[model samples]
Target: MQATSRNFKDNAHRALEDANLQKAMGFVRTGFIDKRKAAADALPEFEALRDAARDIKNHTLANLDRYLERYEAKATETGAQVHWCTTAEDARETILEICRSVGARTATKGKSMIAEEIGLNDFLERNGITPIETDLGEYIIQLRKEPPSHIIAPAVHVTQDQVEADFRSHHKALPADRSLAEPQQLVAEAREMLRQKYLDADVGITGANFLVAETGTSVIVTNEGNGDLTQILPKIHIVIASIEKVIPTLEDLGVILRVLARSATGQEMSAYTTLSTGPKRPDDPDGPEQYHVVILDNGRSAMLGTEYQEMLRCIRCGACMNHCPVYHAVGGHAYGWVYVGPMGAVLTPSLIGVDQAGHLPNASTFCGRCESVCPMRIPLPKMMRHWREREFERHLNPPAWRWGLKAWAFLARRPRLYQALTGLQVRLMGLAGRRRGRFASLPLAGGWTEHRDFPAPQGRTFQQLWAERKRAA
Candidate 1:
């Protein structure tokens, strides 16, 4: 949860060298992409749904203040305490105060990026409260004492063998010969381990995927039902979410839900889509005694009406990262923050200072796959470009980068000179590399050439080819 985004290049290099991580990332490449495409193809109205989802979020963001007020009022009416936090520190302190007030010794947690963003677990531990992650992926990384590598699939960077090892190390009470070779066996083991924790927990903490303004409901979608137990069994349930998660109605929630599952996990719906309106009523058989919603603004309120405002439309479905080549190559930890992939590239800089996270926006290959697959149709590439422009304008970039851009700009302004220089260089490079049709090493492009050979220019530049074709025609 600390910002090592400043060391992204080093992180990426280390990730590339991590053989286990590389093997684990193979799951990402094969797991999400094809499934998402098939799911989208199966639905005749998928594209239309995407547009509707986008409009719904845009409308909600435009009237966010009204919806937030309504949500607070409605939630309070339903006997849920609504706490507004302007900063991460405020949110953390508020949650801790709630825990302390309840005399909580331990808290069970569902997967919450908002919690991760605020460094909640460590804060709670330091304050004498143990926070237990019950989500399977979250549980895996929690035992490893590492940050999540993927938003939806937190332990995606870890291989099965590594997981088996981690389980063997952490679950000492379990038999040493227990079969963890199968994933289901691992799940069963974790389930057995966590069942007791749920009953023992005094407080349950979760993040809301959507906060319904009309009903004061906090919605979470998960493949496993851990979120249900995490929020239900404890004496108290606390929802931590950002302000932008509030939407106008259950109707809007339904629309977004259709796209959210399909985009995130390629399912029509998750195995469990749980919605909690408030605390237990007298008639309810099993539910928390107290319900609390902690809405954190952090830096989101400042993003409104700005070029970055569209980013609030993100559903955290993680479709962008699933399709991003850079994310595929290095995985999420290289991103050095809670959020990862294309969405993270744009959002991290806005939440944390651009100065601290400036490298994230530049991590992209600008393939535009992220935008294409985005259910909300967020223009990720455009936002990243905006970040890059801001970085250059603020002189946050190194002097070498600035000088290189200036040199390119000077040459670009003179078309003939630019073309001539490029043409001559291309010819010389082509002649030099004619033997192998590639360059194993290049003078200034060591980064590109170190891992793989650079393809030599076959002939003249595109402009020259275009001119020749026009004259011939």
Candidate 2:
């Protein structure tokens, strides 16, 4: 909700030291990675589908104004109100006003990152309205009064034992002796608790995975089926999404869907992929009476024509983060914001300011795993480099870093000087650490050496090796 991205180093340090979090992170290291690999490997057309998804997103963004207007007209024709919000405050106020119109005392919510981005839950509580998260992962975090650690799996950072404890602590009406040793037991308990809340809710709010401009439909894919209950049981249904979610046609949605589940959770499809076009028709058995769509810009429009535009293609499948080494080490909470990992590293700085979130872009190892696995082929590593450049240009980095870069640049301009200094330094280090083949500590490299030994220089620099090879040839 709030930007503590500036304190990412401290957050990451704490996360690394946390025993519970480390145990929870084991699920991340073992679960998503293998499942995704297997799923992707099984589908021969997976890569092709990724390319098509990327093209569709790019086309829609290029003609966003036209598609947005068409989507509004179509949705309005179905008796649904579409509200355009240019800022987070505007989006939050608009949602509150809609809740007020319905006299909503309590609202049921499906998982929505945009809501998190806008701080909707706290805002609703401050206005005397209660918001209940129905999605199992979302529900768990809600009870703990914490933000989601992962996009799709909000409670992934929480262990099963911790969840059992949370359920016992929060659901006091339930039997304190009830066994929650298994995940199924926990789910049943949560389901029983939320079943009544769904019926009592005056409003149901959800986030759209994809907004179909051709049909004016809002789509959500979930394994738990809680999203279905959240939207249908309430009298009023509200959809909150960002502008980049809009796609041109159902065919395009189909192409994206083919890859979404596999990339996210290794499923051919989620248990439920629900699409809502509008409110209930006269003949309809059960559905919401009032339908509203709140589309928030929240600084996304500014990214349209820039190099960072590739990031808008993200489907929130979270493949990048799932495969990211940094995320696996420290977990998402260390990012200190709604989005996390490679996608967050690029997108957070864009939504917030580079000055506040500058450290995020620098967190990467430049291993290129994120870009390699991205469903939309977003150049994550390159974008992070761009942000780093922006930070340096703006002087957002500390003075020591600036001076270090300047010193490197000065030597880099003269090839001979750069090679001479590096050669001398490597030889000295090589002799010093020849006994152990590594250094326990090194000057100006405490961050690396403090964690683990720095590998000693084996021989001459790359330039020297290249020169010798060229001479021999």
Please list the residue runs of candidate 2 whose C-alpha ends up more than 4 Å from where it truly belongs after superposition. Answer: 465-473
Best by TM-score: 1
Provide TM-scores for the models: 0.98, 0.97
Worst 10 residues of 2 by lDDT: 443-452
In the range 1-473, model 1's lDDT, one tens digit per residue, is 69999999999999989999999989899889999999999999999999999999999999999999999999999999999999989999999999999899999999999999999999999999999999999999999999998899999999999889999998898779878889889889999999999999999999999999999999998888889999999989999999999999999998999999999989999899998998999899999999999999999999999999999999999999999989999999999999999999999999998999999999988999999999999999999999999999999999998999999999999999999999999889988988899999999899878878999997688888999999999
Local distance difference test, per candidate? 0.95, 0.94
Report the CA-based lDDT of candidate 1 relative to the real structure. 0.95
